[model samples]
Target: MSKATFAGGCFWCIEAAFSSLEGVNQAISGYCGGETDTPSYDAVCSGKTGHAEVVQIDFDDAIISYQDLLTIFFTLHDATQLNRQGNDIGTQYRSAIFYHDTEQQQQAQGYIDALTQDAVFDAPIVTQVTPIDTFHSAEDYHQGYYQQNPSQGYCSMVISPKFNKFKAKFGHKMKP
Candidate 1:
C-alpha cells in the first residue's frame, strides 16, 4: 500500500470520495501541513494551526496508480478555489497535496502542469504541492463520517451532491 494526503476543503467530502474507490484501503480524515502538535479539529478549523483538514489515504498501487488518485482529487474539488470549497473557508480548507515521497511530489506537480498546459480551467490551479511532515489523525468521530451521518446537515447539503457526481463520473472505478 502507498500513502497520499490531500486537502481539498472538508475532509468529509474528500474521505467520502476516496473511500469508495477500488484500490483505496483507507481514507482517513486528518490534519496535515500544520504547526501545532496533534492539533484538534477545533484548532485546525480556527485557521490558526496552519493545518488543512486533510484526508490521508492508503491505497494499493497495483490496483490504482497515484496519477489516477490525483485525477480524481482534482476532479472532485475546485482546484482554483484557494482556501475554501463553497462556505468552508479558511486555510484549513486550502487545496493541497501533502506528498509522501519524491515520486508523489513530482507526479502532483506534473499533473498540475498538465492541467495548466491543457487549459483545463480559466483560472489558474492553486493546489499546493507540499511534503507531509506529519499526519495527525483526527478524532474517531470524524472517521467514516459521511457514511455514518448521511442525513446530517453538512453531509446532506455539501457532501452528498459532490459524492453523487463523483459516483456518476467514476462508477467504473468503484469497488463492488
Candidate 2:
C-alpha cells in the first residue's frame, strides 16, 4: 500500500470522493502543512494553525497509481483558485499535494506542468506541491461526515454535487 495526502478544499469532500475508489483502503480527514503540533477543526478553521484541511489516502499501487490519484485530486477541486474553493475562503482551503517522497513530488509537478502546457484551465493552476508534514487527524465527528450525514445542508448542497461530478468522470474506478 501507498499513501497520498491532498488539500483541495473541504476534507469532507475529498474524503468522500477518494473513499469511493476501488484501490483506496482508507480516506482519513486531517490537517497538514501547518505549524501547529495538533490542530483541531476549529483551530484550523480559524486560519491561525497554518494547517489546510487535508485527507490522507491509503491505497494499493497495483490497483491504482499515484498519478491516477493526482488526476482525481485535480479534477475534484478548482486548482486555479488560490486559498479557496467556492464559498470557503482561507489558506486552510488551498489546493495542495503533500508528497511523502521525492518521487511523489516529481510526479505531482509533472502532472501540473502537463496540465499547464496543455492549457487545461483558462487560469493558471495554483496547486501547491509540497513535502508532507505532520498530519493531525481531525476530531472523531469529522471522520465519514458525509457518509454519516448525507442529509445535512452542506453535504447535500456542496459535497454532493462535487462527488456526483467525480462519479460521472470516474465511475469505472469506483469500488463495486
Candidate 3:
C-alpha cells in the first residue's frame, strides 16, 4: 500500500472522492501543513494556524498508480484557484499536495507542468506541491463528515459538486 496526502479545499470532499475508489484502503480527513502541534478545525479555518484541511489516502499501488491518483486530484478541483474552493474561502482551503517522498514530488510537478502546457485552465495552477509535515487529526465530528452529513449545508452546497464530478469521471474505477 502507498499513501498520498493532499489539500484540495475541504478535506471532506477529497476524502469522500478518494475513499470511494477501489484500491483506496483509507482516506482520512485531517489537518496538515501547519505549525501548530494539534490544530483544530476552527483554528485552521481562522487561517491563523497555517494549516490546510488535508486528506491522507492509503491505497494499493498495484490497483491504482500514483500518477493516476495525481491525475484524479488535478481534475476533481480547480487547481488554478488559489486558497479557496467554492463558497469556502480561507487558507485551509488551499490546493496542495503534501508529498511523502521525492518521487511523489516529481510526479506532482510533472503533472502540473503538463497541465500548464496543455492549458488545462485559463488561469495558472496555484496548487502547492510540498513535503509532508505533522498531520494532526481533526475532531471526530470532522472525519467522514460528508458521509455522515450528506445533506448538511456545506456538504450539499460546497462538496457535492466535486463529488458529482468525480463520480462522473471516475465512477468506473471505484469499488463495486
Candidate 4:
C-alpha cells in the first residue's frame, strides 16, 4: 500500500471525498504539519497547534496510481485557493499535498504544472506540495465525520457539494 496526506479544507470533507475512490484502502482524518506533540481536534481547530487538518489515505498501487490520486485531489477541491477553502479560513484549512516519496512528489508537481499550463483554474493554483512530517490522528468523533454525520450542517452544506462534484467527475473510478 502507498500513502498520501492531503489538507484540502476540512478533514471531514477530504476524508469523505477520498474514501469513495476505488483503490483507496482507507482515508483517516488527522492533524499534521504542526509543531504540537499530540494535537487534539479542539486545539487544531483553534489554530493554536499550527496543525493542518489533513487526511491520510492508504491505497493499493495495483488498483490506482499516485498520479491518479493527484488528479483526484486537485479536482476534489479548489487548488486555486490559498490558505482557505470556502468559508473555512485558517492555517489549518490550507490546501496542501503531503507526499511520502520522491515519486509522489514528482507526480504532484507534474500534475500542478500541467493544470497550471492548461489554465485549469481562473486563478493560479496555490496548492502546496510538501513532504509529510508527522500525522496525529484526530479525535474519534472526527473519523468518518461526513459519513457518520451526513445531516450535520457543515457536512450537508459544505462537504456534500464537494462530494457531489467528485462523484460526477470520477464516478467511473469509484469503488463497487
Kindly list the per-residue Cα lDDT of model 4 for residues 1-176, writing each as its tens digit. Answer: 98999988888988998898899999999988999998988888898888899999999989988888888888777888777888888889988988898988898898889888998899998888889998898889988889989999988998888899889998999987
- Give the residue spans of candidate 3 off by over 4 A: none
Reference-based lDDT, each prediction:
0.95, 0.96, 0.90, 0.88
Clashes per candidate, residues 3 or more apart or on different chains = 0, 0, 0, 0
**TM-score to true structure, per model:** 0.98, 0.99, 0.96, 0.96
Q: Per-residue lDDT tens digits of candidate 3, residues 45-103?
A: 99999999999999999999899899889887789788998777888999999999999
Q: Who is ahead in lDDT, 3 or 4?
A: 3
Local error of candidate 4 at residue 89 (angstroms): 0.6
Candidate 4 wrongly placed segments (more than 4 Å): none
Q: Please tell me which predicted candidate would have the highest lDDT against the true structure.
A: 2
True-structure lDDT of candidate 4: 0.88
TM-score of 3: 0.96
- In candidate 3, which residue pairs clash? none
The parts of candidate 1 lying over 4 Å away from their true place are: none
Q: What is the lDDT ranking, best to worst? A: 2, 1, 3, 4
lDDT of 2 by residue, 1-176 (tens): 89999999999999999999999999999999999897889999999989999999999999999999999999999999999999999999999999999999999999999999999999999999999989988999999999999999999999999999999999999999
Encode model 1's per-residue lDDT on 1-176: one tens digit a residue: 99999999999998999999999999999999989997999999999999999999999999999999999999889999989989989999999999999999999999999999999999999999998888999999999999999999999998999999999999999999
